[model samples]
Target chain A: MYTRQNQKNLTSAQRKRFVAAVLELKRNGTYDEFVRTHDRYFVPDDEDGLRVGHMSPSFFPWHRRYLLDFERALRDLDPTVSVPYWDWTTDRSPASSLWGEDFMGGTGRGPDRKVDTGPFAHDRGNWEITVGVTEARYLTRNLGRPHKPITLPTAEELKWAIDEPAYDVSPWDSRASGSFRNKLEGWARNGAERWSNHNKVHQWIGGHMTGGTAPNDPVFWLHHAFVDLIWDRWQARHPGSGYLPAAPLDRWDRQRGRVLTRDDPMPPWNVTPAQLMSHKGIYRYEV
Target chain B: MRPYPTRCNPRTAAAVLTRRAVLRTVFTAGVVSATAAALAPVFRSRRTVAPAATPGPRPAPLFEETYRGRHISAAPAADGSRGGLDVRIDGRPLHVMRRADGSYLSGVNHFESFDSPLDLARAAVDELGSVRLAAAPAHHG
Candidate 1:
């Protein structure tokens, strides 16, 4: 079992080892495959397949399990490593040294490549990219009916089309693209409303099924993680937002028309939220 | 259920401690026949009570003006759980769950719209009295 001590207090050497393990997972296809196959990991519940557009109560527990799975994969590769969380609160400036190119792919500065230290520096507010009619049309054609698209795109397809390359008209390029800032705005202003709509359909499907139209996308987990992270940050700032007390935990039970749960055993890797709460036993992002 | 102890005299405390130790030993021996008999039925009866389901009518969104002067006044439950006030705002119902950990969770519009769970929980403690639990339906089972 991972302990809080091991994760909460990571050594410099451990950080290097942890980053290397992440890169290794990225290379060996393990990370990509897990994101693709795991129902709770990267599956979105919307027409456009936007993962963060809305989230369910199961969101936190699901990512908690996914990150733990990644951590375990890392440990299996190297026993001595531990995960670290990035406390974005402590370092609000986008130019904070933590984002250095040596860690994430971008140059450790703002999107403009200049050293920035304001709230907008790492500010995700302006990073949002709207799913306008043009992109939405392309996505609808390629993805087919939102309820049951022709086929779920591979993570490679999703990554290349949306995250990696510029938008093109190819039928293969079905998702939207834009800066992270624009997406954040879309989420803030319309996130709850959009999520409520998407969740209604998702809950109708009972929350679990692979190979459907939108849920099939592999970008789901990363997208939701960012959503979950946003909610986390929002809660930190507002401190009064949350699910209703009567917001039935029953809705969270995968057996009760929802696809995931706080305790559901994710396939090919059987783990649960009870196990992930501890910092020591699992791998986590450096928050 | 039963109020066990608020305070104990040294003599009674010592005797209680000794009794607890003795009970632990006796428990291993399976010899506390009468005590076990007294506890079993209570446990069984508790299992028979229906679990509480999520409440309803869904709370409507509370305007910032609604919470301007509210302050929590009641002490928390012994177990650290908090009690909340349910209030009707423009004919809509809201339920807030507050706990002593300085955290709360509230449901707006019965339970349809949820704010951040942790924030709602904290708000419950901060905004008591301003709200009141809606009357339980008269025909509840």
Candidate 2:
């Protein structure tokens, strides 16, 4: 089993190897497929269709598998390279080492929002937005969206989601309040803040990170690694609460075929949520 | 149901260019031209005119507006993702997806889902502010 470490803790060599492997994937076109898959799965519940990647109870497990598959892909290129998590709660600024010139690079500059700095910068010719299933042909970001500056999710905010006992509830989707899945997925739209936790981090990264085709930016892996880590933490906090909708939804329900129940097989992989409920042997997150 | 083309001139070419890009990625040039011809009526009002006589009451089009100086147009997504609307801000594409709860989301203001594509587009314009959107789109999916 491998352990996912925090980005801030990675040795310069480990970071270099990981970055190299990612660039390799981008060069050979495997990376674009990852972007495409994420875009394909970015279905919303209102579409009332096959929604697995987000806005549903499967948010945690689905991403767990997606991240795992991505890690495996990277390992194929370099066994020593493991995806590192970016703990937005701590290493939160655009200037952090996570965005250092030697690593993921800094935010977009100028009016076009082109990320001129970074290995993935368009001028670098290594990471063009090819299969993002998106419009931006080059990597772009507006860190903190300066005009409307938003911060990375705070530790306190994450605590609110991890503390929720129920893994998910009936009518399992973004609006399903009290469900740990939606809370951590950051779909709560009431009160002062409309976006929280996971969603807030994406918002703070703006540009390519702002939509379903977020993988266009390499930080997507680090950000999602942290999200996956949060899920692991949530699981440890509420061990008794398991994946929800233990059985399938009623046939009459509109979401019956769309939302994956505990045992339902997620498409593109056919793996059940129950099967991915644990990462004890597959991988572990280092705080 | 697929989204029809949104009304506007220059924006139509941008949307068409995006559609053409997606078609070239996934379909043949013949299909691309056919699609362009099909959508031609939306912008090419001089040709392919609609009938004066119609059926039952027509529903108000869901997306067609200029929010905060950014012109957004909605049409059926060429990729055929469910409830996926092919929207463009100014002359650049603004991809919008429908969530299970009937809200809208896009990469520009990606964190939260808005009530409709228009709301989502407006929020994206607000988030984008003065930054101009890069032209053209890709269909790597």
Candidate 3:
């Protein structure tokens, strides 16, 4: 569905139309106002009464609906416009022309911006080495299997690792929550040194689990696209992520908590991943 | 019958017909006069109208230096190094890096994911503290 090779290639006319569409939605009060109202999508169980693991199985569906709504807003503004996907895999190296000035703003040189050269060059003393460590440990123990500790790679290696398919790892496990909680506690009791180890682990698994919610980092989208691509690749490789049996208790439509039976209507809008993979049309990025 | 009708006929019919014609004329004149007065401003305004084609403000530069690649954009930071605060979203740590040119970049985990760099930065600032500018690394090839 992505037509353009690069966002820079988007015409001024297209950008104007897209902006107009988004503005129109905002003017009409049709835009998602959640950013103003809520702090985050999933509140940590420890901080808020909100249960961490209690997010509905329909989380994916809800996000899909939200994104489609935004896409519809864009389409309403200009029917010719399509949402562009970032292909991080092809532009694996930081030295490629892909990192040019017209693209990401910086001193106009180097992968990570030099501190003295441009705007926003400093470390925002705000980096909570502690929180970073704690989170890193939680993910490692839960999503990753026990292995010999690995060293954090250079920034270039980190970038390379994001797209490497050989690093594919499973994020969910049967005992993920407990393990995550235990790791959190261990990291908390320990000092910054303990946290540093967590940071290393964070970098390692982070490069592997390329698709999670980390949008602030420029690499987040590319990583996630690869992650999504991996899922697609997996289906192509293994046929499916496994299917839910057609049972009375299996609710395919999680929002409504309604069970999906064989006889039930499977509308195109509410297509299951299995159904999505089965369609003859599949998306692949043009390198 | 002819003698009785003769008394009521000619004089009264002539007077009534005259009054009706006068009233109709006056009413037509009043309506026409009012319409002309009402439309007078429109004609005056049209004559004083300014040129139809004035230039609009120039469009914003076609491309923002901040964004790189097809979907990539740089986040700005004060420190020489583009690195800013990092945060965890849905169990992932996002490194908020600023470019030397003053744009920003943060990692996104999915193709269809809706998180933006600004979103991630704001979250980091919210969780950690405001960003402090750091020294740019000495070795930038």
Q: DockQ winner among the candidates?
A: 2
Q: Write the per-residue lDDT of candidate 2 for residues A228-271, one digit (tens) a residue.
A: 88888888898888998898775445467778898999988999
Interface RMSD of 3: 26.3
Chain A vs. true chain A, TM-score per model, equals 0.42, 0.97, 0.40
Tens digits of per-residue lDDT for model 3 on A1-287?
43322434545565445445544554465542422111133222111121111122222222333344455665777776544433433433434332333232122122221222111122322111111211221111111211223333233333332233221111111112222211221121122322212223333233212222322222222333333333333345444233232233322111122222223333324554234332233234433
Q: Could you tell me the TM-score of candidate 1?
A: 0.32
What's the CA error at residue B16 for candidate 3, in Å? Answer: 99
- Give the per-residue Cα lDDT of candidate 3 at A180: 24
CA lDDT, candidate 2, residue A19: 89
Deviation in angstroms for A132 in model 1? Answer: 20
Candidate 3 chain A: 10-residue stretch with minimal lDDT: A137-146
What are the runs in model 2 whose C-alpha is more than 4 Å off?
A132-135, B1-69, B73-87, B91-93, B107-110, B126-141
> Model 3 - which docking category?
incorrect
The CA lDDT of each predicted structure is 0.32, 0.75, 0.30
The residue-by-residue lDDT of candidate 1 on A19-109, one tens digit each, is 6775576557675445343422332221122121112233344455555566578788998764454332232232444333333222212
RMSD of each: 21.8, 11.5, 29.0
The DockQ scores of all candidates, in the order shown, are 0.01, 0.20, 0.03
> Top model by TM-score, which number?
2
Per-residue lDDT, model 3, residue A196, is 18
Candidate 3: tens digits of C-alpha lDDT, residues B1-141: 001111223553464457556545755676665554554444333222322222454222212222221121232222212232223332234444332122333432111111344444342322221122122211111
